[model samples]
Target chain A: MGFLFEQDNFALFRDGFLQTIELSALSALLALLLGTLLAAFRVSPVPVLRAFGTAWVTLFRNTPLTLLFFAVTFGLPPLGVHFSHLVFAVLALGGYTASFVCEVIRSGINTVPLGQAEAARSLGMTFGQTLTLVVLPQAARTVLAPMSSVFIALPRNSAIAGAFSVGELYSAQQTFSERGYSIFAIFFWVACAYLLISATVATFFRFLESRLAVVR
Target chain B: MSILNRPASAGVLYDAPGPKARARYRLFGVLSVLGILGLLWYVFAALDANGQFDPDLWDPFQYNFVQQMILDGLLATLKAFGLAAAFSLTLGALLAAGQLSDHKPVRWACTGIVQFFRAMPLLILIVALYYAFFAKQSMWALVIGLTLYNGAVQAEIIRSGVNAVPRGQGEAAYAIGMRKTQVMASILVPQAVRSMLPSMIGQLVVTLKDTSLGLIITYQELLFVGKKIASQPMNAAGFPYIPVVLVIGPIYIAMCLLLTALARWIEARGRRGANRRTSPAA
Candidate 1:
């Protein structure tokens, strides 16, 4: 415990903590954007796009995040695509997490009653109009809880990025253990840092859910 | 209309296409198909130019030792998954029982344990376990970490499943001469297991995948083996990372998909069985 407060050791843990948050935030944004697109594609009138969306979700959802990280870290460089390690971590985590997010959003969309869409169609709303104006807004409400779970899992999954040299909290653990510090104390703090992040994310989502709650 | 063939959720998003709409969709579809094909071709060309498509890169997989290594890795992964699955389910059941206990302290303690473990990132937990207790035993570290985290998740699943049973079921059992344990064993658990099975299997898939984290601790699971293979530079072009991914990736996908399919099959059968049981009584 005393070693935790040592100047150099504290900096190492702090930097690792910040890097974890940075990776999670960036990847969450990417997952949301890509996932929304996939969800829309899955529900759209275009057969090809729907097929593509389904394939993307299935392929990604079944694959382990670690393997995806390996592919991005090792496989991509050979194909002439290059990026920073952080960027690679983001791509892998975001891409994998997006599959889950897509399912959450699509299921959310499904939970919106069919009558709502039919009414919009009766008003001669186009597909885009019905989806954006009528369907998606309603879906957003039901989607929040599951969507939160998905997002909460994102930071936890980003811990894998540490193994790939993204210098996150897990990497902090690696560093500390190698330096011969007390493993239990170091782990306790690292676990606390993770729990804090998860709790904060959980709280934010609960707030959002409350704000978005419909009285119906 | 063709909308009748699609799921209500998908179909309701748009009306059946009229002639103009149909024409527009056809053109958009064609363009999107062309775009996807173009992207695929670009990727293929890039990989080909980089000599990733060379047959030599795949040579290591053909060797007897390499194949045996993969087989051993697969067995090791399954062995860990088997132990973790058993332990997690047992732990989940105990924790769920404790959470649902009559004593307030017991319930609170169980809830705290579940929440604490659930909130921890599993990799961190595994690594911590590796260093703290199982420094020389990576498999136990992986298994115990998986069990703790997944058991917490499974506890929630089981608790919710039990609660989801209509309150009348338990009341009626108690209204008879049934003891608490008897009521739970005969009435609540059997019913809850039906609903909980799918999610339990789903978690098992997750446990299977998380086994790959063993690679970090130098546990020789399938992914670890694959990584080891990929790191060995057999050809001048590069390490066979792509080849290893192609080989090992499908094994994982196939295993998960098979489990998912099995769950669906069992669920369908359960529904049919329930229908048969009620239909005759009706």
Candidate 2:
């Protein structure tokens, strides 16, 4: 525990914590954007686009995050693609998480009453207009809780990036362990950091949920 | 669910297209197909330029020793998954029981354990356990870590399943002079198991995927073996990283898909059996 207060060790820990936060934040944004696109594709009238979306979801959802990490880290360079470790980590985590986010959004869209879309259509609105203006707004409320879970999972999944040389909290755990610090103390602080992230995300979602909440 | 099988709610998003709309859709479809094909071709060209499609890079997988190593790794992955699945299910059951206990302290303690473990990143837990206790036994470290995290998840599922059982069912048991333990064992659990089976199996798929994490600690599971194979450079084709991913990635995907299919199958059967029981009674 005393080692936690040491200037150098504390710096390492803070950097790792910040790295984890950056990874989670960047990937969360990517996931939301890509996932929303995938969800739209899934529900659109275009068969090819729908097929493409389904394939993306199935492939990402079924594959292990570690395998995805390895593919990004080792496999992509062979194919003439290159990026920094952090970028690769973000791409992999965001791509993988997008599948889950797509599912949650699609389910949320399902919860929107059929009459809402029907009313929009009867008023001469186009499919795009009905979806963007009518369906998605209603879906957003229901999507909040599940979306939070997905975002909360982002930080946890970011831990895997540490192994792929992304310098996150889990990597910090390894460094601390190697430096001969008490394993329990190191894990304790690390766990607290993760808990704090989870709690913060959960609270943010709860706040959003309340603001958008509609009385049945 | 497969995307081809559209859900009932899908019809809400759009009505049947009129002639003009249908023509527009056809045009859009063709453009999208062309776009996808162009993307695929680009990827193929890139891989080809790098000699990733060379037969030499894939040749290592043909050897008997290499095949045996993959088999051993797969078996080890399954072994870890089996142990973790069994232990986690048992732990989940106990914790669920504890959470539902009439004793307030027991319930609070169980809730704390579940919540803490649930929030903990599993990789962190596994690594911590490896360093703190199972330093030499990486397999146990992975197994225990998976057990703790998944057990908490399963406990919530089980508790929810039990609670979802109708109040009248449990009350009837109590009204019939059944003891608390007897009511739970004979009434709540039997019903809850039916509802819990799908999610439990889903968690098992998660556990199987997580066995790959054993590679981080040098557990020599399938992914670890794949990594080992990939790291060794073959003649002129550089490391066989792409080949390894192509081969090993599908195995993980197939296993998870199979588990998911099994869960759906079991759930369907349970629902059918349930209908039969109710219809006969009616």
Candidate 3:
């Protein structure tokens, strides 16, 4: 257990922790952007966009994230499409999570009063304008809490990147646990680190919600 | 994604396209279709060049031995899922009850356990359990690991469901001189079970899929079996990567869809008021 905090081991944990954070942040950001686009497409009048968005969600969301990683890591690289294992992992995570974010955002969009869009329409706002200016802001406000769950989930899911040999916390735990220390101790400490990350994301979003909350 | 039954209010963002807008939409549709086609073509061509489409690579599944292995693997996978789902649900129900307990220590203890398990990653939980706790018996490790992590998730679902029960219902139970346990068992849990049935089933779906994480520790589940099949030297196609994915992928999608279909059936039963008898307190 003491070996966990030894100078060399400590650096491994530090790097792994930072990498986990980076992976989560990058994946969450990408998922948010992709999800928002899919949400917009879902509500669009264009039949094609709506179909594509539906296909994206159905195909990716139902498949396990592990399989997605398997496909990206194994399937693509053999076809002469090479990327860093981390990059493929990020794509896999973002791709799967975006489907969830799309659902959460769509539910939020559905919550916005229909009359608000009607009112925006009467004021000469185009469909795009109504969505971007009136609906999205309201949807964004409503989805912060749900979206926070998605982001919190992102870091935890980042652990799967270890399957691809990505040097994240899970991989670090694997390494340390292999070094003859108690595996439970290694997991306990890494889980504590993850708990801190989850709590921070949850707490920060809570603060943001309070600050941005609007009275009806 | 779009196959979801659209709620009646789904199209709130915009109206139907008018004549000119319809023409523009059709053009956009054509371009999008072409883009998708081109991407698919690129993948097809590249994979062909890489020999991923060799029929010889896929022919191994025709053998009894290969087929039996996959069948056994699927059963093993289901067994893990079944155990995890049962234990996790039981654990979740108990933890939820404790979190809602009248005693502060019990409530706090349950809450702490739930949060700790929820915060931990499933991979680490499974791996740690495999290596540290039950190194000799990998099945117990996987099952218990899944139970702890997913039990935490199910605890939230159960807790929220119980909390969502109407306050007046509990009050009425108490007015009838019902004890805390009785009120919870009869009044709150009954209603909560029906209302939260969908989410509970959703969690089960996740649990079933997550059993594949056993692959990380050589648990010989479906995904791991698929990996075993995929990695075999029976084919000269340099690892039948695409062929393996093509076969194994649909099996998973089918199972997940089956879970979803079951959820829908249960939901519809509730909607039809067919299960009202289950909630005797109501």
By lDDT, who's the top model here? Answer: 2
Q: Write the per-residue lDDT of candidate 2 for residues B1-282, one digit (tens) a residue.
A: 666655567667877899999999899999999999999999889888999999999999999999999999999999999999999999999999999999999999999999999999999999999999998999999999999999999999999999998898999999999999999999999988998899899889888998999989999899999999998889887899999999999999999999999999988998884343363352
Off by over 4 Å in 2: B1-6, B273-282
**What DockQ does every candidate get?**
0.69, 0.76, 0.63
Better of 1 and 3 by TM-score: 1
How many residue pairs in model 2 have overlapping backbones?
0
The superposed Cα distance between candidate 3 and the true structure at residue A86, in angstroms, equals: 0.9
Calculate each model's fnat, 2 decimals. Answer: 0.79, 0.80, 0.63
Q: Write the per-residue lDDT of candidate 1 for residues A121-161, one digit (tens) a residue.
A: 99999989998999999999999999988988999999999
RMSD (Å) of each candidate, 1 decimal: 2.3, 2.0, 2.7
| TM-score of the first chain in candidate 3 relative to the native first chain | 0.97
Higher-TM-score candidate of 2 and 3: 2
lDDT of 3 by residue, A88-120 (tens): 988999999999999999999888998999888
| TM-scores (chain A) of the candidates | 0.98, 0.98, 0.97
Compute the DockQ of candidate 1.
Answer: 0.69
Native-interface RMSD of candidate 3: 2.3
Estimate how well candidate 2 is docked, as a DockQ score. Answer: 0.76
What is the per-residue lDDT of model 2 for residues A1-216, given as tens digits with 9 covering 90 to 100? 788998598999999999999999999999999999999999988888889999999899999999999999998887778899999999999999999999999999999988899999899888799899999999999999879978988899899999999998999999999989999999999999999999999999999999999997
Model 1 stretches with alpha carbons more than 4 Å out: B1-5, B273-282
